[model samples]
Target: MTAVLSARGWTGSTFRSLRTRNYRLFATGQVVSNTGTWMQRIAQDWLVLSLTNSPTAVGITTALQFLPMLMFGLWGGVLADRYPKRRLLIATQSCMGLLAAALAVLTLTGTVRVGHVYLIAFLLGLATVVDNPTRQSFVTEMVGESDLRNAVSLNAAIFQAARLVGPAVAGVLINAVGAGWAFGVNALSYVGVLTGLLLMRPAELYPSPRVARARGQLREGLRYIAGRRELVWPIVLVGFVGTFGYNWPIILSAFAKDVFHHGAGTYGVFNTLMAVGSLAGALLAARRTTTRLRMLLAAAAGFGVLEVVAALTPWFWLFCPLLLVIGLLGLTFNTTANTTVQLACSPEMRGRVMGVYMLVFTGGTPIGGPLIGWVTETYGARDGLAVGGAVAALAAATVAAILAFARHDGTPVSIRSAVGTLTGRRA
Candidate 1:
């Protein structure tokens, strides 16, 4: 009977979080909008590449989209703590839709320039400065703490699932008609999210009280994280891993082109496998009722180790399959860290915490991408993966040791013994 219960929990449908009416609506809208978002991403890139024929132009567009999050993400989190997330989401989502619509119009009209693409990309990034945190913290409001982990997992699954479908569909659209129609479809996708927001019953949401306007709220949020060990380590782990480990675009493409001796086709295959593993990992996370710090450490370390192993694999078939395991570990680390951080903080500060969480998780990419690219170019793809994986694993182990090195029962714990216990072994 115990085994049966365990099996059921492990394999249960991840869609259980969708049982809440408000969340169900919100999620429904997100899936549609996310699909469109991914579509626009591919089409936008294709449009830029077509205009300038320069990979540098493509990189700049990518950088512009993420720069706002790095710059204003904390401020966005501050706003989330100060206002209603639903209203904020509504405003942000609408702005995003309008931007997509404008881009569609520009592209379809045959007057679009690379400059136009760059400006819009930056503007869209600006919207996400608020949207990312508001959307993240709002999950707790939608489902409360009991179901928060499940909801977060479902969110990851949805994004990855859309990721799987969106790019392929966008490729078809771009090839069949043009990038313009893809943008148009993405613009229409906003209707789903907007309708979801408009229809959500305000009374059902478990909102944190709005933060009073204050001068030092940002510093307060930082201090909140600083004093708490649980919060600090997870965010640090994400920063190390996100910056060094998650730059797959640079590392994987290099592997496919230089190592595998294939072109865009192999690159797509590697990405698809990664997405598939991520989706599976997310579903696996949705089944567990509890989130643990130990799980985060394990997954983070495993992710790094797998990258090292993947980098050294000599055969193409061996390298390809390793990516799936690496992808799984990557998503597992991400979801665990996300759930842990959100659960560890106070309701009032959830927004700020998540904003910081996202800032490190994504903002590092700009830094990591170029650094890893240079490493890959200078050495090889194998070295790039090995170096990134090593950093992630080392960060995970370091955090574990830090977490373990505390006094217990009025006695000091040695680092070696503490790390062993923290990592789930008896010393």
Candidate 2:
């Protein structure tokens, strides 16, 4: 009896699910690769800003990087469903690594043109169109349903934890070694994730049966979401928050330099501080086994409200701490929404569901970044942040009202119970 009990206990260990070996390699590789990814992100944004000294140019670069996701994410989802994710990821990651290396070479040689940046940015965005859904869905293939939720939260935790370290390190590296070095590091970072994918045991992977690739697959994913009001509403909330509200950094970057009267080093510190709060939120999320809708709604509200306060503050010190709060609330909302949507869908539909999820969540950035950039350019940074927060808050409120009406009609999203799942407390 003791032997049986011991076996059962061992089976339930958190890392036990990773005993599959393939997942262990995948997770390990992701950690290293994701850190490099973050480093490049910091470097890329800084490089564009230094080259142009125009907020709109930075916004344009950001838009180019995400526009492909908006255009191709749904199709990417179909591919994820219809093909072997491992093979697809190998192709896409290789493309991205090459792009990163090329960009580093351009910048390092002092021959990088703005047009060159724009073109490469667009190509990178296009690759991400394939990469995002494939990667999101790949989590399930790696761990199966038994550990899917934990794996998703852990993925976010790992991503943001890298955020905690990567930006600060990038700041130091950029200041000391030049942005090209950061890009070079990013190119090398792809090696870790690529190696992990190569090492994963094919036999242990969850087999996704290929579906007939069809026209109107994006519509099918949309219709699947529409049938569930809960699912639709959270996605709506994310769309608003991601597109407009989450552009705080872009807005704050301008304000930090102009309104708050600071410099690049100060800008780096602000980002790092936000990462600190975001890391805390991600860690808190990792403790949960299941997710609910109400929690998502509440967190979305907090995310918007915090951004509003952060914008309204007059002093740099006051506003910076508020950005930290905004970061914490934003991650709580984002990670919860991400985990909930993934959990609510059927395993077979996960690729598509997550495809739309990534589309709305990330696709918004391109549209929002430029729009917010225009706002900052026109009205100044403070107004941009305030307006963004206001819009996001209004969207959240609208979704909440729609959700209430849906419940009156005898429909509620799984998110309705999200709060209880995390805290074991009822509102």
Candidate 3:
């Protein structure tokens, strides 16, 4: 009886966020849409590789896809604070659907060029700049602050589950029909999310206080982060890892073609395996009620170590399992950092805080993707992977040292205190 009760308790804690109807709706819709998004990502990367047969070109395509976020992500955060998030999501989601459809048409018509791919990628990035921060901040409305961490972890799980399914399906589709149909399928998947958004009951939402129009709001947000060590350290860690560590598309593409001599099917298998670990990590995170900086740092360091091990593995089979461990550690780090940052910020500043977070996390991709690609092309895929792993491990070590030194020096600085101060009042 005790064991049965413990099992039930664990299950309930793992899914507590789903008790909120709005979050349930959001999760259901995201499962479908996220799958479709992953499908497109796999198809797109494969298509780019096929067109140019150059890993560097693949890197360039990735750089273009995320460049807009580097430029407009902060302003996108500003818009999130100023506008209704649900309404904004509808617009962004619609535009993304249209863009996916356009890419599908281009691919099917046999008129697709590298330039066309580059342009569409850039446009999609523009939409993402607005979409990311709003979506990050929107969760508080669905489940309120009490359930925000659980909701975020569940969302990560949903995304990773989709990643597991989408790539495998995309690989089969790409192998059987072509990449065009995968894009078409992705375009249609947007309807699920839009429908979910439209169906939400506004009365059920716990709407956060919106900031009024004010000059220098962006600077205000920046200053808010600067004053908080908890926020600053996590953001800095993410920037380094995100920029140098997460260029998987480039790394995987090179590995698939150059190292493994495999086709799209093999590439998809690799992604699915990685997602398995990520999904596990997300579920583990969901079971916990709190986030910790130590967990984030340890996971980041583990992720780097695993990547290096994977790079050194001579056999494709050996390398694939290492990616699973890497995925687990990477997702654990990301979810912890994401939850910590969101919970630390005031609701009014959540949008901008998330915007800066997303900007640093993804914006660095433009610089890192191309550089990693060039490295893979010039040296080898293994060497490129090694470099990324080393950088991530070193970054984690650096941050850990800083935190330890501060603590040992009798500094009153603490993440708990930083969070208390940030969320205690509006910026």
The 0-to-1 C-alpha lDDT of every candidate, in the order given, reads 0.81, 0.77, 0.89
Question: Residues 1-427, candidate 2, lDDT per residue (tens digit)?
Answer: 1111222335544334455567667777777777788788777777777788877887898889999989888888888888889999999999999998998999899898788888988999999988998998888888887777667666766676677677777788888878888788889989988998998889888876666777887688789888765467677888888899877547756875778777656667777788778877776776677676767878788777777787777777688788777878888888888877777787677788888888998899899999999888888888788888888888878877765653433333456443222233332
Q: Largest TM-score belongs to which candidate?
A: 3
Point to the candidate with the largest lDDT.
Answer: 3
1-427 in candidate 1: lDDT tens per residue? 1111222234345666676788878878878888888788767766765677444455567667778888888998999999989999999999999999999999899989999998998899899999999999999999898889999998888877776777777777877788998899999999999998899999998998789999999999999988766677789899999988987656765676678877444555676777788888988998887667778888999999999999998998888788788878899999988988898899999999998998998777667766776677778889988999999999999987777564243223433344344555544
Ranking by TM-score: 3, 2, 1
Error of 3 at 102 (Å): 0.3
| Candidate 1 backbone collisions, by pair | none
Question: Between 2 and 3, whose TM-score is larger?
Answer: 3
> Model 3, which residues run further than 4 Å from truth?
1-11, 409-414, 417-427
Residue 127 of model 3, lDDT score: 97
Which window of 10 residues has the lowest lDDT sum in candidate 2? 1-10
Q: Candidate 3 has what TM-score?
A: 0.94
Candidate 3, 199-297: lDDT as tens digits: 889999988888888999999999999988778989999999999999998999889989999999989988999999999998999898867777888
Clashing pairs in 2: 230-413, 292-415, 292-418, 293-415, 293-416, 293-418, 294-415
